[model samples]
Target: MSRKTLNLDSTLYDYLISQSLRETPIQSRLREETAALGGPAGMQVSPEQGQFLAFLASLIGAKRVVEVGTFTGYSALSVALALPADGRITCCDVSADWTAIAQRYWEQAGVAGKIELRLAPALETLDALVSEEGVDKVDMAFIDADKERYDGYYEACLTLVRPGGLIAIDNVLWGGAVADPANKSADTEAIRALNAKLKEDRRVDLSLLPIGDGLTLCRKR
Candidate 1:
């Protein structure tokens, strides 16, 4: 199998959360609100991942971030809360219904001022940033949208972010389906191909963490 990660059964996973997970009122409320919507609420990242994103952004002193997906605003809230008051994050999403919910929570969280939502195809928005905002202006990017476009989103983020800036891509593992050859769906294939490409692409240092459906962190070199 070549994989060395310990299998996380429910008991072990619960223990891990009990030992380390920290949930703020705002975060908890947003999560509950998202959950109340049900259906695709599973798409909301785990609280641990949200905290990790904030910690990573703060650790690197990120001032500007581009978020490629803004479902209910949890991830954006995570990174936005960590940023300096003057910091900014541009969010790209196609769902006005979902983003409207996100906006309400962001306002309640008081980070609304720092987050800017652009309702368009993420590709178009990302490319516009490269042309209008200039290369190396963004400090970080988090991609969690359509799986088929991960490569294009990554390339645009690579251009927008400063050298050494981070581009975090979610769902690379696709619920462990990426490793299963039996799963050849369009999304799965796209993620698998991108993972293989990243293995040999020397433009950045990479770490594929087994968190919240496998997040791949690529730091541009």
Candidate 2:
């Protein structure tokens, strides 16, 4: 038996997806469309990661959610699909071009009515949420925006979610750069700082899984 996470080569990865992934046709179509965009398509979460987000939302019986990044809305769609009919998710992003693609798929998915897209700087949207919704009202939050401001987003989400609420942060490993001392680029440094901070922060129970680019699951205490 393995003592730690097994490294997934392309073969193993494909096998894993073949065995476990349950992507819907719409989801698959969206993924294909996003992939056609080339490099930027990498910003979208893997199918497994999207499924995990949906699982988390369902686990908590989440009624209200917030998303700090809404790239093509795959993650949002995943979570939206899991929410009850009355549930709502506020999505924050700045790219009209990208989110427009998201809107079409969301409409097709029939979850468009549940999502509120705020096209502005994420920080602004998050701050406004804190003012309007107050502390501990959100059930879950997913953060995947600008790496440099991750800490700020984390703090805001921490306040937005109640005790036992969840905040899922994407790219904590920053494509494995956080572990390499030589990669001191601005984005890498920011992610590294947040990783270190999250490890010690007693306000939340944390787990950094070896998922897509590393996903940090933080349950607020």
Residue 184, candidate 2: Cα error in Å is 0.7
lDDT scores of the candidates, listed in order: 0.92, 0.95
What 10-residue stretch in candidate 2 is worst by lDDT? 171-180
**Superposition error at 219 for model 1 (Å):** 0.7
TM-score of each model, paired residue for residue: 0.96, 0.99
Q: Model 1 over residues 29-103: C-alpha lDDT tens digits?
A: 999999999898988888889989998899999999999988999999988999999999999999999999889
Q: Which pairs clash in model 1?
A: none
Error of 2 at 66 (Å): 0.5
Query: Cα deviation of 35 in candidate 1 (Å)?
Result: 1.4
Clashes of 2: 0
Q: Give a tens-digit lDDT track for model 2, residues 97-190.
A: 9999999999999999999999999889888998998999999999999999999999999989999999999998888888899998999999
Candidate that would win on lDDT? 2
lDDT (0-100) at residue 197 of candidate 1?
A: 96
User: Model 1 Cα displacement at 71 (Å)?
Assistant: 0.8
Model 2 stretches astray by more than 4 angstroms: none
